[model samples]
Target: MAGFVAVIVVVDLAVHFYLWKRLVRDVTRPGWRRTAGTVVAAGLAVLVPVTVGATRGGHLWWLAWPGYVWIGLMFYLLVALVPLEVPRLALVLLWRPTSRTSEAAETLSRRQAIARGAAIVAGLTAAGTTGYGMRTALGPPRLQRVQMPLAKLPRSMDGLRLAIVSDIHLGPLARTHHVGRIVDLINSVTADIVCVVGDLVDGSVAELGKFAEPLRGIESRQGAYFVTGNHEYYSGFAPWIDEVASLGVRPLRNERVEIGGLDLAGVNDLGGAQYGDGPDFAKALGDRDPSRPVVLMAHQPVVARQAAPFGVDLQVSGHTHGGQMAPFNLVVKLQQPVVSGFGRVDGVPVFVTNGAGFWGPPLRVGAPPQVTVMDLRSS
Candidate 1:
């Protein structure tokens, strides 16, 4: 944890320093303007870590909102800065011609102004994008309806609606209100089965247990089933598994349950093994009727690689959050086979949700939160 914190601090400091040098220092010459710019940059640099600490400490609860917002803004600005810096670097390195003619001086000034203007535009764009992302994150999750066509699916299970909610990340930023709203929305869907694919809470059960009480009210005909996501392991997996079970939600850890003539199974998240409780696919799928189409819930999409060999009919997962923002989704794709929506691996169909909550940032740009309602059909 100390190493992780150190890395974050170093990266954040570098980004802030770059912003200060390229945008602030260049635009504001040494004067009162420069002094003010320095102060603002320093404040932002401090705010990044301070707010994060406040949130982690669970002190000054109000700081969480601004802290997370700052986090989102900083991340967006960092990405935006990459493109904006290229021209500035070129101007500094390649455009230093010795011809000091009047036209050349005027042209240099105009080009410098243009670069400054571009930096300002990039900053504003990042802020605007962050604001819009926050709105989407705070808003109710969008309902996504999908059809899961399973080969030889039981007739009794046909048209069975399964609601999938994952990656709630309930902590300082996401509290009871968010969970309450989610419960009401999921209840309204009237799903036959509701599956929560893990990463439910950021803190331990002791800290956020009360906030999660709303989950008990989730109404479903077959009850809600949960599987631990990587986040769950990070935040006391054992107790959380028990706490969720107490909430009338079933936590399937390499276990299977028969529901409506279909084999519904869930395995521990892939991260579980790092903590000595890795997913046991063979055990979860063992002793199952091969004729019965199986629906597996594994948190990360990459788990489909294992599920494919088992001939699992479908796998429901959420981790990528569809990159949770633009360009980042491209990055997420490099790690996970499917960022969001439906895809296939080894001919086994998989559905990876964008998730219903934000993680580090209280914002969702390109990948919006979702309450997925998958209607199963026999193909």
Candidate 2:
């Protein structure tokens, strides 16, 4: 835990330093403007850690909004810095031939002005994008429908509508209202089965129990089932599992349930084993009817690799949030095989949802939040 915290701190410091060097220092400005810029940059640098600490301590709920907003800004700044710097570097390289000419001073000043202008444009773009993302994040989750055809699926279970909601991340940012809205949305879908694929809450059960109460209102024919996500372990796994159960959502800990003529199983998040008990695919599928089509719910999309060997007909997952934001999806791809949507892994169909809620920054770009309804069909 200490190491994790240290890494975050170091990264935060590095990002802030780079922003200062490129956006504040390199830009030519008056003495007062420079001083103001330095102060603002320094304050933003400190705000991230301070807000995180205070919010985790659970005292000032108000700080969470601004803190997370700052976090969003920081992320955009980091992304923007790369593109912004490239142009400046190119300008320098292009001007080398005329370095000793009388036009050098003019060229240097022109280059600085252009760099400063680019910085301002980048900042505005980030702000506009973040603002739009924030609105989308706070909006009701969009519904995504997918059809999965299984060769051995039971005729009786054909057209079985399964609703998947993942990564709600309920905490200081996502409140009871958000969960209530989510419940209403799920209920409206009239799904045959509903699955909560982990990262449901960011804080402990004791801290966020009240906020999660609305989940009890979720209605489904086969009832709501849940599995651990990486965030669950961080937020006190046992208590969350029990609390979710109390809300009438079954917590499937490496367990399978035969429902509606279909074999449904759920395993702990990939990170579960690190916290003590992990996913046991063999045990979960043991004694199952192989003739029946099986749907496995694991949080991370990468878990499909394990499901393939087990002959899972379909694997439902959501951990990538489809990159949650632009370009970040490119980064997410480096980690997970699929960011969102349907794909085939070793002949098994896998559907990864963009998730129902935001993780950090309360903003999402490129990837819109969703409550996916996957209709299973027999081929």
Candidate 3:
């Protein structure tokens, strides 16, 4: 599909430039300028779509690139459709082509045309600037925190607090400074335990060396635990797991950590071998004391359905980015049983965060980034 789109774009650009060059030869005046204009316009039109597509990852971006390019073409048509009435009207009045032209009338016509052109340019500029600015300023970043009460609590730790941060895609866009900010924010939160669901890095374990400094600052009374997201699988999971552990962040791969009479289990990406074909949530729980509360950290929330039957009390996940876009919430909805926010699947409770850092575009359109603060309390 990407190949097909690339072919169409290449062909379209070729035909456009070919016709534009022909027009330049036939036209008597300002032909070179028109050719230059066409070249510049085509260049601008093509690059934006490609850039938008390359930046957006996951499956939808794979399909949207071709259609998105055409969307850019529509934006071009909008700009051209704007009427050039003022300049043409001034030409009619000043030249008076139907009658004898006066010197004063000619000067006035030229001045009016220039003034009207400047006004049109200024108005368009202001509109574009205002629209972009408003969206940027008002489009709140997708970050949220929620705490829920537990009806059945473990006696050993009745009111335990847990801070969950996930999808910190540390790469070119999520630099050291951005990560440092998150580290500071997480530290500021009052929690007994910290859990990082997954997608710690977007590219490679090499990224760890750069951002590892901030991981030192992430603090909790118990410790910080991590699980692998699908991105981790693509981004060199082995080295990343080692690097993360070196920073004191325990990467739990189909493993469990006992904390304050509660069982905390971290599973590998459902796609990985550690999960063994398809993960059996009850198996992960094993024969551990069911009387004590069980907290499972799965990168994706679909595990909730299986975990609920096993009496898993709480499951924390962060992969959806909470739809990331307004209407696309439907897509995220269809894929995951739980889209975002807090929900109870049968008997088990699930908390899916939008994530502390963004994956692509560095822009959070609909779902604001979040550091979820969950405090477990006995009923």
Best by lDDT: 1
Q: What is the C-alpha lDDT profile of model 2 across 256-348, one tens digit per residue?
A: 998867888999987878888799989887777788778899999888787777889888899898898887999998888888898887776
Ranking by TM-score: 2, 1, 3
Candidate numbers, best lDDT first, in rank order = 1, 2, 3
Clashing pairs in 3: 141-368, 142-367, 142-368, 142-369, 143-368, 143-369, 143-370
Question: Who wins the TM-score comparison?
Answer: 2
Clashes of each: 1, 0, 7
Pairs that collide, model 2: none
TM-score of each: 0.92, 0.93, 0.68
What do the candidate models score in CA lDDT, each in turn? 0.86, 0.86, 0.67
- What are the per-residue Cα lDDT tens digits for candidate 1 across 1-379? 8999999899988888988876787676579988899898888888888877766624566777877788798778878777876776666566555566666776666566766877787789889999999999989898888887887787777898899999988888888999998888899889999999989988888888999999989899998999999888878999999999999999998999998788899999988898999999889997777999899999999998887778798999998988997878888888998888999877778899888898877899988898899999987
Candidate 2's C-alpha runs over 4 A off are: 57-59, 92-108
Report the error of model 2 at residue 65, Å.
Answer: 1.7
lDDT of 2: 0.86
Residue lDDT tens for model 3, 1-379: 8998788687666644543332232222356676676776576556545655554333233434344433333333233323443554555465543335566665555555554454455446534543442343223233355656665576556668888888887765455776787777788876688899988786666544666568977888999998888877766778888888988888777778888678899877676654343354555787787787778999899878767767887899999888754445688888897778887777678889888776544444456777788878776
- Candidate 2's error at 128, in angstroms? 1.4
- Which structure is stronger by TM-score: 2 or 3? 2
- RMSD to the hidden true structure, all candidates: 2.5, 2.3, 8.9
